[model samples]
Target: MKILLRPVGLTFFFLATHLLQSQASAPGGSNLLFYGVAALALIIFFFIVVSVADNFMVIESKQMGIKDSSTMGLFPNIREFFRGKKPGYLDTAHVYTLTKGYDIPMAGAPQDVIREPNVTRFAVTPPDYFGLRPIPKMLVEEGDVVKAGDPLFFDKNMPRIKFVAPVSGEVIGINRGLKRSISEVVILADKEQVSRTYTLPGREASREELVEFLLESGVWPAIRQRPYNRVADPDIEPRDIFVSTFDTAPLAPDLKLALRGRMDVFQAGIDVLRRLTPGLVYLGLDGRGEKDSPYSVTRGVEKRYFRGAHPAGNVGTQIHHIHPCGRGENTVWTLGVEDVLLFGELFQNGRFDTSRLVALSGDSFSEPCYVRTYAGANIGELIAGENVREHSRIISGDVLSGTKKSTDNYLSYFDNQITAIEEGDHAEVFGWLIPNSAKASVSPTVPVLSNDLHLTTRTNGEKRAFVVNNDYEQVLPMDIYMTQLMKSIIVNDLESMEGLGIYELVPEDVALCEFACVSKQPLQQLLRQGHDTMIAQG
Candidate 1:
């Protein structure tokens, strides 16, 4: 199955090079020498011309483009990305600028939730990657009175990176799953719970000192590494850091609107993150909007604009485009803009300030607005008002990559957007035959039913065999052989996975691949399992 179903993208690449080599060595080899040399010469010439053209475009773009607020002199990432001598990685600067993706136009997200709501409860869980679980070390038990900034729990594997209490509250209870792994650390907020203060060092701290400050203050787990999408190791030094300010997912919240008055803390957070990596700190913004996008106004980081459909605002996409994560390149870390402010505010004010603007969106709700609330806050009241439909799926994050939760469930500790989507169960007559113009699908042969077009908690169809269609590649602008990687993962071939560049791939990186897959095989779950298997074998 694996051998038979290679991704077309890789197939064309292999044939293009290997065909020339094999033919050159065939019968009457001496007769074909001139043709082979001419072909090879042309290929080299084409490559040189393209590189020169790209360099010209970069200079022209810089001369005409407006400078960002903080002009950090000489970014090495941009330089290395263009003049890179690495194999298996495309020059992303050109690829990203030319890439295009499908846009799922969702109404009601433009309606920002701007009202400040009261918060009396909060919860923190070892964030689940969909149904995939994590092993957590419990730091506090129920009925224990804890102050804000106090460590609640941390990954037992990476104990130095602690997950802290978002609010000053009493430990009410714990939510667990199979195997008794720690789940949610439910906190009943007193609102006046003791302030676990953070004191900044007087002098500018060294790299180790800054790491200690972030670790001790319980804010270290906020930024996650890309290779495994796991909590970054405290001991390992990062190569580069990525901070994303906008989300390009369907019904994504507007960062410019969300962080309107929070630039001070945002800048402070950027300063702290700059110390984490000796390399560049890249900031990705939504370029589809205005020329002066609010997030583009920020200072003190390497700025890059990505204007495309969904996943354009994804940190993995930005990182891949700006600087592709290569083999053993585990130093890249991505943090949300809101989480950036969380660390900054925690460091500056000496108390945990978990208040952030969460955009509640979807067609289910009556008024989809941005609400000012703290992390782990019981979103029950926030989304309790009259909604358009029932059996709605309330997720703590965006449509893609967000975890599924009930309306009563508290927001995930790491999520900044809560979404409510309608339930999907009913199957239509000839569902795969109806053209779904209302919704966007990568595949053209398969027509998605109109009623099936909307967001739902259900997988519209059943799982089937792997089909190496161009649909997945059309939606994903990243230069990866999706079919080859998926086939390798399905067979649990670690060597093949590594050789195919699975190091740079994450669950979210393949979310679109799953959606576009006619097979309906859960691609995210497979990627997670494959990644974990690699770690377990090691």
Candidate 2:
């Protein structure tokens, strides 16, 4: 079935790609090469053949795995180009078998150096954001004094996974709403910012002891399961664990810059993590470096270097290439680099410090920079005094997958970016209807957008019926049929959803599909709804 659609996906993309590569001032300059009648006939015929073929396709058997190396993987890809390729990385010969996912045109990457800040008051958000509805059980009440590394709350569903306080302070408030579930726990810090240390059983601590300490210190939330993309259940042992060392998202925080001078602690965190799983702890890092970036050099774990675009840095993508998660299988657990640093700090020096550097970016600001702050810090602090144009948006993460927020809101617990972008609310005479060669786009049907462009909330087009054209297959490197999965999702077929490898996806993985959909469907939202339904039932 894929062999039938492969040419449609590859050919259509090549047609638009050449326009980007052309040095002409405009996509066809004055001649309008792509607009010629001959081109129009071919375009219409191409879509007709694909749309007709896709309409009759159906999958009766359930199967999930990486697209055979001879074929495409998640984000069916290209050797597009790597501007930041380091020596010894990205060998042209075997790249086809090695990498997946191509970097698309995007703007607003933070280039600022990381710094530390002293936070007066710190807060911790509930773990429910990941869609893990942990029944909130508060361990402390308002005005109660507590030390750093102390427990603030625990999941009622899984009491062993505790939310730890980051600094010594008084519990200022237990912000709960509706069903009396805890929403936020605010701590008014003591002037000295003290932390209580633990006398460990030593470096030779057993796996069970390590797991217990992580839970006691409130670091258990860092280990998240994949089948559900939620906080891992400490009770169920995982088959393997993954840690992503690079940030390939547009304007992603530089791991090498962020982890500077923290290698010892990072390594210690790796050792600590090793104790929690009897399975291998896979660390994904950037292979584009001539010499191994400090982020990739660690001991006691399997190090896999990824050499491709955006989602390449995503642990989910890496997991697919390494070990595909299938329905009813114990999910592969993934941890972030920051989570490991803190987890190690709890055991290394017994001091808890959540303060770290955050990247501020987007075209709305005059310049992009990094600010030192703690998790859940006030969002206002990061954007103060910036040239925030009228109708500008402040996002808590990257533009592709981040949540928009008012400066008044607190940052999310796992966020490391504060993006300020202009809202694209104003309309154009015939926006996206005519050729605008100056614009950047990956679609052959739309105006050609510059390779580097700023995006907004503009839908650009209206929602329409799901088209069976092979456009989505071009962007996703996964093995499942893009159209079949969409068909299953629209009708809410849980069995088909599972068969389509829904367990191996998150919104970030399909965000490009949302951007490229010709029908302007809220693809990410659909994918989110589809997964949420499955997880709620899983």
RMSD of each: 9.4, 10.8
Q: lDDT of each structure?
A: 0.71, 0.70
lDDT of 1 by residue, 1-538 (tens): 1211224334644655676778778988765766766766676666556545545555555455433211222222243345324222222322234254666555556384487666677888775422224667778888998988898776655667777888887899898767887767888888565768777864478989989888888877777876887777777778899987777777777777757777777887888888888898888865554354566556778877766677788888888767777535456888887778887786656667877778888877777878877877787866655365677778778777788887567888777778887777766677646664655466555454442245565555788778767877887878788888888988999889988878788887787777777789888888888887887886
**What C-alpha lDDT, on a 0 to 100 scale, does residue 362 get in candidate 2?**
75
TM-score quality measure for candidate 1: 0.79
Model 2 lDDT tens row, 129-183:
5764544777888999998778887766777887788678888877765686666
Lowest summed lDDT over 10 consecutive residues: which window, candidate 2? 58-67
Error of 2 at 282 (Å): 1.2
Error of 1 at 251 (Å): 0.4
Ten-residue region with minimum lDDT total, candidate 1: 68-77
Global lDDT of model 1: 0.71
Clashing pairs in 1: 112-370, 113-369, 113-370, 114-370, 122-376
Best by lDDT: 1
